[model samples]
Target: MSSRPKAKPHFRVSPAVLGPLGIEQLQDPALAVLELIKNSWDADAKRVKIVVDQRKAPGKILVNDDGHGMALAEFKERWLVIGASYKRALEKSEGGRPLIGEKGLGRLASFALGNTITIQSARESGRSFLADVNWEELSSAASLEEYEVKIRRGAVTNGTRVEIHDLKGAWSSDHTEFLVAHAEFLASVPGERFHISFKVDGKAYRVKHALATINRLAEGSLEMRVAPDGTPTIRKCVINGADEKRIVFRDMKSDELDPTLAGTRLSLKFFRRDEAARRLSGVLQRNEVTEVLERYQGIRVFRDGINVPPYGLNRDDWAGLEQQRTSTGGPTLVPGNSQLVGELHVSKRAQPHLVITAGRSGFADQAAVNALAKYVRWTVRALGTARRAEHLGISEANVRVPARIDEGKDRPRTASPQTIRAALTAISRSEVVRANPALRKKLEDASQAITETLGQSEESLRLYAQLASTGIAATSFSHELRAEFDVVSEAIAEVAASSRKPDKELIDLLSTSWGRILAFAALFKVVPVKIRRHRKTMSVSELRSSAETILGLASPDKVTTELTIPAMRLSIVPAEVDSILLNLVSNSVKAVAESTNRESGRIRVRFEAHGNDLAIHVADNGCGISRSVAQIMFEPLEGKFAEGTGMGLPIVRYIAERYKGAAAIVRPPASGFATEFVVTLRNVVQ
Candidate 1:
């Protein structure tokens, strides 16, 4: 009696709700145009023409395609229906073309460009259906059926034409350029003859599919092609404008089989900033170079020749180029999002799992996307390394040394204690010594003071270098910590915003962040401890083993490292040994990663005793150091590689000199190694 009836509410949505949100979702006009093109593709159109007529009043955008069009009944059931899964129902068109349009919302994107849209479609039956939409009417409609959409039956011959009128805004030059550049992707379908011609103000420009050939404006470029079976062939192209030479590399892994690299063929071009390079690139004027850079800037992902949005956009660093540079603590010559221009060619047929998102901003958030990102990041680094080497050879105006010490005949030399003692002894038995005994004693005391000062001076220089190295290391450490902290902070904030209870995701995030923090803490503990004067007995094998272990912990698991040292003791500071080993290993790792010939790289370290000194040889099978870098390998300057802070080799030299040792580059004794560095250290009594 108390509970006579329970009330139930039915939820209803207005069709006009999407009128505003759909327009807002199309934040990019280029993306809106791309959506229309995708729709044409999904319709199995073999030839599509886009005519941009802005010279006249109101302006107009007409997209005409020769494809299997729609009938009146089908148009009412699917075309006019919002969020219809008609494409998804069949999965493929009648002509066997994969349905590129998933979300029905793409059709609504027309509202972002113009106030009026007319869709005319026809099947192979030589008859057509026409439907016209007034966006204003749809927005003010009280109900879905209230808006009047003009529809006609058997209006035209077999084909589809979309006419957008009353342009919302003017299309800028950048928009046109975007369309021109993206045409290559749109026309890239294999074994299919698809043409997309663009016409503006009665002028026409046809987009070409140029994936099979490359036209790059750089000093050097690396092109990598991976087959479906995971076989890779690498070609290094040296472009001196019209004179281009290509060197093909064989027997390299290329990491094509990696989960992230599956079904992706990479083409990475390296650019140079030198005047010579700019001139060679046919950029005669500064403005011309600017235009070229503007047209071909950023890394783009092309799926079956269609440019996927957001990946290569100005602000999108899908390849993590900036993060990789930051991780290396230096300016990446590997090209940031704004500097490098290339394409990650993927095929929908080959990589079905790499699904595009409904928003069209990028691929869906999944492991495959992450893998693609990782592979791209690695390729960027590799290209940057190669380009940096090429850039070093470009002559500069100033031929001065990077570093100089003031020690010449023109500069007065400071007298040392030994020089003063020798002078005094020369006059000790002479009349000057007898005439002024007090003077002789004063001279001897001054000599002792001078010797102490010189000792202090040496110590000061050593400390200065150590402090400089530490300052650099500290800056990098802080950057890494800040990045980790950002993740942790985000996770904590997410957990706090939860409904008063932590879910499994929140717990996992907390655990992961905490683990990363702990790992960094452990890594920080191994930062080389400066112990210039503190000599300790250390086993060569033990030092190498410890350094390798620390390197293994810090480095990515892909790098292969091997340590070869006899269990012999050396009377030197353990920290210095660690510093030497660490720097060399780090350099080797970078070289290996950058090498196109050796995708999966290896570093080998061997220790040998030479008389009263220890010669530690560190080698790698990476892209070898150029002659220019080799000549100044230990010159106490930043090495001429992109992945370096210009301090790694210098640090090695600094530590070597402190131990009365020397670090030098030598020819590798074997074929397996690309570059070899020998560090000689003096053996002392501990």
Candidate 2:
């Protein structure tokens, strides 16, 4: 029978299979951006405008594209397809360039950050129409088939416009931050073929050219292109403002056989940022060319003349985002082994892949050329070289061995860290695995195992540690009180011995002394404490003396110790400091009990300033905690450590927190098992 051919097991993924992942599959607002841009690109719009206004609570965003427009039937067929368009169009070389929005999901990017989404489009066929979608309605609907839509005639003459209103998921501040990130992305769009403008709170956020910093810094030019046979080759390098003085570097030889110099490639080039300004602007303006041809900034790297992994040169105004506690913050330092360099593969599909996350995950799986992974290491070295040159104008050759780390990725070999970043970066990316078959299978398998627990675990650990530390502090306080009783008894004995003078004053002193002693003993018996008379902020000098007092009283012959405190103002209640001091002294005495040279076992305490932070270090020359031990020391369960209720450090940590600081067990004073406690406090006055 002419029955349908057996279905291949390959194309098995259904929408039901993709529906379960809420955040990973859909949370990236970046995808939505790709969608909006894709649609505009598909329309063949010469100019596209992106507007973001946080002043409107949920954020008012609109993307306008002046493209060839669409017909009513075409719009119904094309615009309505979600995740289906790319499935049909991915076979071609271009991802629907004359059209761009191949992956239907790009249109939903607006929904990533907000709820209500509005789309207005006009075509050459019937008439302009507007479609409003309240995503909240989708949840209660029985199925995710084509939604019920309210369509009305729109006023636009041509092209399409999308307005995302009443965005529900976030507030205005977050919207402003998103706009700043969007501006950075706009700078990288093909300037010759694409035009984009972004306005945030009335400020023009989009810059139509390369980064001014990169422009101001570009010093030279180099280009690489694939051979007719598809072999990548690097050609001539030109020194800018140096009269086109050329330097011919041979193509890098692949030493796949030899273990040393295996996959490593060293590329050192300098560019004047101004020289590359408007590299995107088609038909470069004469004035800009002249400006670029003159003096410029330092070094930068490019893959096929397009800058990738922006080596900290482009100040995208998101620097503030990289410093705070927000998940958004973290300096945009392209890590040495990171896979963020999606610019290396500059073929037709390459550049697009670098801009989206879906494309990135695929590139990280490649075995032939883990270029992004390789190039990151190079970038780090170049950064140090750049820093040294900026500070002292020294060539990188003068630095220590500049070598790459070997991660056994792709081909087994060594690569300087900078080159690793270069290797990991690429040029193109697609969301659907089918879009890039080479990466689809692996990425899909990995996506399934992703649980919410991975990222959330950091906070979980912090809470657990906080509780454990508090419990330890309470335990240590009890140990300290028990030890203090003997000292009180000895002090009274000394006073009684001096009362043998038999004078009138001695007789009266003896009578009151017993009463005061009884009262002192009663102080510990009751819940009352002389806390009001105890703690206050003290200088380094006072802290030093307290250390000595606690040590001298604990056990003078047990072990010798040293104290190093700089003359500076410090903020810590003296009572707290005293407690910390006494605990540290007692621990040091115990550490040396079994030492061969018991007299030589030593502990040292030092307080130093690091920028605005205060670091108080307590070090010992006894047995040290191993890495495995150190990792779990802060945990609730401690190893079988004698003389330790496992609470000494936890209490130290608690005291540090009350002072708004952190405490950790570090290296001791130059011996095995020597433990160091580090307390870091913020904003020390001096």
Candidate lDDT scores, in order, read: 0.60, 0.44
Candidate 1: the clashing residue pairs are 185-305, 334-384, 638-646
Tens-place lDDT digits, model 2, residues 1-686 = 79898977744333342243222455645444545765665566767887767776867778888776665566668766655674334523133342333445555566665667777777654368877877677555655563576777877478778888775444343444443443343335453366777676677754344354343444433334344433333343333333221222222234312221122222323432222332434333534443332211222233223332222222211111111111111121111211011123333243333332243222222332334323323333333233323333233333432122211335332233233222212111223324556444433322221111212222322232333334522223232221122222223233333432222222222222232232222222221124412445666666666566554432345556677877777654555555465556556655565344466677777778887778877777655557887887765325223324355555666677876788777654344436777777776545
Once fitted onto the true fold, the runs of candidate 1 whose alpha carbons sit more than 4 angstroms away are 1-12, 54-57, 89-93, 96-98, 146-148, 201-206, 209-213, 216-261, 271-294, 314-317, 322-341, 346-354, 366-370, 382-686
Per-residue lDDT of model 1, residues 426-496, tens digit only: 43334544465764564344334324433232233233334434532221222223333333433433333
The number of clashing residue pairs in model 2 is 71
lDDT (Cα, 0-100) at 558 in candidate 2: 56
Model 2, poorest ten-residue lDDT window? 317-326
**Per-prediction TM-score to the true structure, in the order listed:** 0.48, 0.42
